[model samples]
Target chain A: MADHQQKSDKTVHRHEALQKKLALKEERKHHNVSFIMMILLTLVAFYAISSDKIGDSFAVMFILVLAVVQVFFQLYIWMHLSHKGHEFPIWGMASGILIAAITVASLMGMIWTS
Target chain B: MSTHASHKKRTGLMDWLTTVDHKKIGILYLLSGGFFFLIGGLEAILMRIQLIKPENDFVSAEMFNQLLTMHGTTMIFLAAMPIIFAFMNAIVPLQIGARDVAFPYVNAVGFWLFFFGGVLLNMSWFLGGAPDAGWTAYAPLSTVSAGHGVDFYVLGLQIAGAGTLAGGINFLVTIINMRAPGMTFMRMPLFTWASFVTSGLILFAFPALTVGFFLLMFERVFGAHFFNADMGGNVLIWEHIFWIFGHPEVYILILPAFGIISEIVSTFSKKRLFGYSAMVFATVLIGFLGFMVWVHHMFTVGLGAVANSIFAVATMAIAIPTGVKIFNWIFTMWGGQIRFTAPMLFAVGFIPTFVMGGVTGVMLSVPAADYQYHDSYFVVAHFHYVIVGGLVLGLFAGLYYWYPRMFNRVLNDTLGKWNFWLFFIGFHLTFFPQHWLGLMGMPRRVFTYMSGQQLDTSNFVSTIGALLMGAGTIVLFINIIISASKKNIASADPWDGRTLEWAMPVPTPEYNFAQTPLVRGLDALYVEKTAGNGKMTPAEPVGEIHMPNGSILPFIMSVGMFISGFGFIYANWYAAGGGLGIVLITMFLRSVIDDHGYHIHKEEVEADIKGGRA
Candidate 1:
């Protein structure tokens, strides 16, 4: 929306903008470890093979567990929940997930018994 | 030039169409929401007329369903939420002494989406039928629901729900990030605190609704087996999800009203809210507990005794917090120099009326007892009391409280008193006897009672009460127009209000504050008035103010969804495809063609501060 005016008030702003740019760059560098871990986790999720072709509900359970863990990582790292800049959104999202889990789980339990 | 502006700084219809100013967007919300509220109110009157006599034939069964659906959906979503939000957007930032909300552009997007979505939902009337499933849109019936009515319900809500969610996020960010310096969270006005919690509830609650809508959409449109009995999908899941959102949604609408009433009572009584901390705690607790107890809506769904018992307890738990709030408001006025200003009268009226609703709610919480009450006129009476007495009364109070700030004129007090009494008496009369009818075994949502059902007399009386209520609503609209045209030109602080918004001039500056007002204490502006500084201290020195230029893109974005909404509704493959194309293309254009927003230079800002007018 601000493309109308061009010149003036550039000197002080330029210095401030440059410092912000550098800080962003350094912050990106600090996040490289988490980025690699997320990729490695995704590869494991896709490649892991289940043993014993018959009735191994255990493997399905294990894979679903891994998928659940991977979802948390995606929420934190990929979805930027781990990033300090998004703390407010992170907590809000966590509250939503908690409530949703409770509703779905309790309903599922009711359906199972009935 | 367009109707609202001349060759103004931001000229052209395109300006407002695309604009991001929170105040302008607030006006749009009011305009759109107000129209739907009228339609909803009209629907209510029509339903009343149909029930006026024994075996009345005024409307067909299908039409009755449509009217009821539109009435509930429009009032709750289009009318009530947006109306309150209109005041919040128009006044909250100004109240907190901030120049603008944190995400001004997204704010515009939110309003446009809501506007367009609302329009699309109503379009169902023209598209053969409006959604006839109750506004709750439960499954089985909705799945078997003939025609494109259910499609409109699913897709229209999906679009509108997106808009509401976006607006929620924007408000949350704004309240968290944009408070003026020295305005600590605790020191914030109760209205701001209420808005903050309402926004938080919106953030969590609305998404569950969106998810439910999608599941419904996929089930209906793509033949997904999400709710199909033969496919092992449980229809009950839909009820659970809807109530999950529906229950919290009541709080989302009411909490703001609670905040407004608190402000009104304290200001009129010449005191602070007597138990401010308790009120705040209660507000937060309501917001939290709103999530835990969606099942209370479904006691008759045969959640066995164990499940029912647990939920019954949880439902009753809401009463503790609610009671604390009611007590606080009453105490706030006790022994004080009570001024029965129009707004204060409404606040005082609210206590007993809402207490009635709360008592019924607690009664409904008794799981065994609810079996008799559920799906009856009793439940109907219960909600109407809460909604009309609590929410509508609070909204009317706010309209009076902030009329001067909104339009630089005071509503006629005599007319306002008449409006209040007519509405109060009419509302109670309309819904009160519903308890008796329910106890007599009258099920709710039935188009008509059989001629010999023994239900005729009560229904007739209810219809008469409805007429009175309808008459009362008319008096309100008349008061508004007459006041707008002929009422006194109110000065700043028209009600001797104790909030930051009152510190601004009557016709506020286009730039809200020249320098943001400094906050030294709670009730920042009132503190200044009492300690005898005639006006607020400026928190910041004057400088350039960055105001987002209104653009037509938001309008286009909303129109895209509107088109897509019809596409989904009619099951027009080509229309659906084309509509998605338009919507996605607009979004892409918005991203790729970035316009670094316009700014009000230091000189312009100073000039605005000098001449405080829109």
Candidate 2:
């Protein structure tokens, strides 16, 4: 009975190890995809800013959009914000961004322009 | 790190100076905060005496200005903020079933920084003069003010504000990460929930003040052009930034007060807080809205009609969440068995008093009306109604409610009641007539008024009332001293408290719980009493407890900051460099040192439990 139990334990360990390996591979795939996408977005932003075809105003807006997207990729893939137990960090970041945006917009509009 | 010699706790003054225990630090906050409260109260009484009769020269105009600035700064920053911190440090961890704050070292650092910073600010009285540019310290006036008074304000608040920010982050992390098993976010007591939101407000709000202070400091010390309009800097920017921080700061003060009232009212009424989830929702909503309504403070700044309307609406919208809270408190006591403990009286008093403040607040929120009310005695009446009537009363309630937990003695009930009535009635008498005085064209921050303006009677009444309030405060001090001296120990569950904090043994152990409590539901202790065994189930088996070692480093670091503040104020480079060097050296030492902390062994914990001291 002891021998049988040991064999079953070994099997469970092996199964878990295999599962971990597969999950690691999947995570690597996701990271690589996000990395490539971020690189592409940065290049596109550079093109928009440098290219003669894109207007200055439109390019500024486009690059801003790209920057925001890149930030999400960095947070999710590199910082692992997509992982479990990151709800608090996400809430914190979101609220912080909201407040910062409001403050900048109002201060600029009220003081700088005026 | 695990040396047997480190197992013994330090005692006496050395213990307090080196202590990192949350409870000890809390006591330190309370003691320092109480001291500052007295100083601020004295300043207020002096000002009242000056204003007692028309054309009275009890204090010079310059003296009154300094007194006014120091009074507002001290009461808000030194007294109320630290006292709120006192309760937060003492109660939040126990409520959430945690051994200590998440970063105990940082907690100590925060306290000492605030302490030294307050001392530095007060030291201005003897050194040169207290800041006379008003607590708001609007730009060019502060920038061009003679002497080092404003410099003290800039540096002292900057240092103190850093401490507040550290404390805020510590509480946030503690609440988010340190709850015992089954103590979910939803199950957290109202005070803990309120603290969590207050911490969030502090996190976002304090940085604005820090930036404002830095700009002001640079302009003052380094001759920077940040707030100098002639140097192409706009003075309005200072106002904007100050209010941005200042508005949420009021919430930061009052939210914890709201939480205290909620706890006291519910506990004394023998009921679970009515609309628990709604209360939590309202708290979060209020916090969010607090940031949005900074512009209301600036409505008279002429940001434009559109801006005023938008901010005005946002300001009024906050009333919705505040109303929700007020009704919830009333409903909490609707059908329950209400005990008129001192804490309960304060809580009951808070309900109507805070509502009056809120009513006046809504009245002031109208920008068109604010044009008439701006910088008037009406504004003073409105804020005093909220701050003194709302927050101070709530603080008194918390002191009575949590006295047993902090020290194993209940305050004297009869004396406590006298303290309440005197304070409560005096508060009304003082600020209630200020509204009429404002309407009758009495301005704030003034030394004296003309004799025949119909303001004399109100001013006289207000002065007498201020004296009564001062007397009430004295009564409370006597009550504290008298109660603490008595030998009769309070039971573990004094007042039949509903939350986990009340479940501890009479003299709380250095390690709060002998074993981690497995929280079952909202009002965890009460839930257990009603449905299961009348005790918290142990989440873990008996085990050794690891506690952080007391360190003097936080004290040293704060001393360094205090020195740096002086250096900046006086423009002494060597002092600044030396201070910075001291801080850096301490940081280096802390990084390299490996103090893994000592442990209370399992046997000792078991013995404590058996002795009824855990």
Per-model TM values vs. the true structure: 0.91, 0.96
The RMSD of every model to the true structure, in order and in angstroms, is 6.4, 2.1
State the C-alpha lDDT per candidate: 0.83, 0.93
Tens digit per residue, CA lDDT, model 2, B1-614: 24455556678988999998898899899999999999999999999999999999999999999999999999999999999999999999999999999999999999999999999999999998999999999878999999999999999999999999999999999999999999999999999999999999999999999999999999999989988778788899899999999999999999999999999889999999999999999999999999888888877778999889989999999999999999999999999999998999999999999999999999999999999998999999999999999999999999999999998889999999999999998999899999999988888998999888888999999999999999999999999999878899888888998999999987778899889999999999999999868999999998889889999999999999999899999999999889888889888889999887888888898888888778
The best candidate in terms of DockQ: 2
Q: Tens digits of per-residue lDDT for model 1 on B39-98? A: 998898888888766667999999999999889998999899899888888888887778
Counting clashing residue pairs in each candidate, in order, gives: 12, 0
Task: Specify the highest-lDDT model's number.
Answer: 2
| DockQ, computed on Cα atoms, for candidate 2 | 0.73
Candidate 1 chain A: worst 10 consecutive residues by lDDT?
A1-10
Q: Scored by Cα lDDT, where does model 2 land?
A: 0.93
| DockQ of model 1, rounded to 2 decimals | 0.41
| Model 2, C-alpha of B515: deviation from truth (Å) | 0.7
C-alpha displacement of B73 in model 1, angstroms?
A: 1.5
DockQ of the candidate models in sequence: 0.41, 0.73
